[model samples]
Target: MEPVLLAAVVLFAGAYAFINGFHDVSNSVATSVRTRALTPTVAVVLASVFNLTGALLSTALALVLADRFIQLPAGTPGLGILIAGLLAACGWGLWTWWRRMPSSSTHALVGGIVGSGAASTLVGGPNIAESYQVLLQQIVLPLLLSPVIAFVLAYLLVFPTTWLMRYSSPRRGDAGNRIAQSVFTSAFSLGHGMQDGQRTMAVIVLALVAAGFSGTTGIPLWVQIFSGVALAAGSLFGGWRISRTLGSRLVRIDPLRGMSATAVSSSMLFLGAVWLQIPLSSTQTMTSAIVGAGANQRFSTVRFIPLREILVTWLVTAPVTALLGGILFLAISPLL
Candidate 1:
């Protein structure tokens, strides 16, 4: 790749990292804000700070997984593919924003890369089956499972705790629940750093590798630091629109329920970060945990209406972005 073009690709990837941070900010703070445990500004600031810390401290598991999924063949025309992928992701993001639907930027990026890979195959580029399998196992399976797991777990955990606390004074119960919420919220922030922040780090590493600037052995410290800063800055800005939907629209969350949900979600995210090294969607995991906690109280606690919209976005994200990526790649290839 030409030096100038590679620089442009790296810059574009950084922009994507920032957008990913902004797009997913709600995942980290929505429950805390909605429950009034933390103000929106305070919640975001804390989450942002923790996000940067997590990125800096955690291992680069997601980066390796992503590289496996989207590695272009040696001598593959990378500039066109990179540009198309970024453009396609941006297009999907804009569409989601316009519709006021919260979608996964990670999914959008995957879609773009897959689309470009398919386009490359049409012109006799390297096979990408390994990448596809990684996507299926890591991304798709987790998306399907996280919410169901969260809903079940939350439902089971919340009701029992509620029942146990029923005889207590409301004031006493609130105080205890608030304390628990604080702990769970902190844990969730750490997990958010481990899981969500790592996704951007992975992308940055991928861009560097593509540009012949890094390797699979490990990510450079500067890359880790820069990616962390970008993501944190984006989180600090926050996304109020999606936060409302997640924090309030999903269900009425008291401190106890909030703690239960956050704890379960954080557990899942941390496991993914530490063990699987797969890039699971924090939004999906947390939402599922929230649903599970709500379901523990009653099936009615799980709001099906907003969930229906989210499901639609989830289903459409991969295919639509993939198609867009393919189109963009084809259009830009000749110019390159």
Candidate 2:
């Protein structure tokens, strides 16, 4: 039974990765495509290749997630809860993608795990304090601050960039900006792969350890390849609806502005998160940077309605996934 459950968990985790790939590729490619820095096909293809290569950049993030996410009781975790959590997360991810909403797969996964794991505590899991710590230190802190960091850094850098490039004529400026944007896009995709892409491995390893299927919880080479490949494949497909939402609805992207945003976002991920081995939401990081870029030119250039909608989605993602995850736990508990 444990073996069966382990297999299922691994499959679910892979599915989640595939879903996450499509969900987030937009974050990296949207601006580039929007600004005409790269055609949509080229942008997506670039993201896929870069993401695939950087997928296993580090295992620290996987360790952090597997160890810190949910503290189950001693004996063994209820496989039902783990399975249900993954399913709920995947469901939420797909739903949001269909709705053209750019939601965080990490957010959905955390919410699903918390909701289901919290319910398992009723049967003999650890205290809620552990979950709280996971939320505060691991999830919430990174989620809230990373985006702000992305925004601030992007906002600050743009003015200087704008000033320095002011002397160049339109054609020269456009050429320079395109070259810079290409570099920035590649860098951001690498960072995105290192940070967000490793999470799929983390979740699967967590489930393996929790279920006692694997002796070790560390992310193995196989797990890295598996997760990375799945995510990259999803990115290749690309989320057109979400991409449109990110690329168009929020702000009209220009090459110079998009380059600034991508540069800031990549720096933040590589230094602020990846160096620290933390799982930052690429979705939020990229979107916030784009917002900051727009605001750098003029505050009014950004559309409030779509921005508001994405915020509302972010705000509700946790609790709603929590509810769904808990309900799923109940429904599946009997089988386990």
Candidate 3:
């Protein structure tokens, strides 16, 4: 890739990270805002700081995301292909965010890449369709299982936590738990930055390798530094709508419920990042945990309608983004 193309790839990847900072990262602090443990402004600021730190904290997850989910015969995708896929994901993200729906950025990105990879078949590139098997094991299976794990664990976990606090005065326990919730929210936000934010780091790495600026396994320091900053900057603005949806309309998130959900999501991310070394979707985990927390009270009280809408969005995001990415790549392939 030329310097111009490389620059464009960097910019697009950064922009995607920035959008993710607001769109996906909002899930981490939605409960904090709803429970009034942290005000909206405070939550955004705090999350931004922690997310930036987390983005820079490791390159392992970055490698996980940008590595060969769809390995090209050329080793990596071309500039045009990456741009098409990323832009497709970005468009889907912006659309969903504007509509105040909590969809998975992970799905959008994977879809975009898959779609673009398919398009490569038209240009005599290796069949990226062959990659679905690898991806099914690495990406798809985990995505299917994450929510199930989060829901069960969160539902079970909420009972013990609430029961243990049963004897403490409601007002007094609430006060102390808010602080605990804040700490958990902060940790969750950190994991959000590292796990979700690093998807963009992976994009940058793939771009670098394609551009001959870095190796597939090696992440440049500049990529880490810039992705963190871009994500933090994006988190600083326009997260309120997504925040509102996750915090309020999903289910009434009292401090305990909030803490329960936050803890579960944080644990999921931590395990994925450290032990499993996979790129899990915080949006999916958060929603599942939130549902678990709410359903623990009563099934009808959880508001199944909004969750259905979110589920629809999640179900379609991948195939839709993938389709969009394929079309965009095909349209632009001749130029590269």
User: Among these predicted structures, which one has the highest TM-score?
Assistant: 3
Ordered from best to worst TM-score, the candidate numbers read 3, 2, 1
Per-residue lDDT tens digits of candidate 3, residues 1-336?
357777888899888888888787678778887888998788888888988988888878778667756564343347667888889989999999999998888888889988888898878766667778978888888998999999899889878988899899999878877888899889887888888777888887777777777777777888889989988888777467787778878787778888888989998898898788887888999999988887788544687788899989989999999999999988877666
Best by lDDT: 3
- Candidate 1 C-alpha error for residue 76, in Å: 6.0
Clashing pairs in 2: none
Quantify all predictions' global Cα lDDT against the true fold: 0.73, 0.81, 0.82
Better of 1 and 2 by TM-score: 2
Flag regions of model 3 displaced more than 4 Å. Answer: 73-77, 298-300
Candidate 1 minimal-lDDT segment of 10 residues: 71-80
Give candidate 2's TM-score.
0.94
The alpha-carbon root-mean-square deviation between model 3 and the true structure, to one decimal in Å, is 1.7
Summed over model 2, clashes come to 0
Candidate numbers, best lDDT first, in rank order: 3, 2, 1
Candidate 1 global lDDT: 0.73
Q: How does model 3 fare in lDDT?
A: 0.82
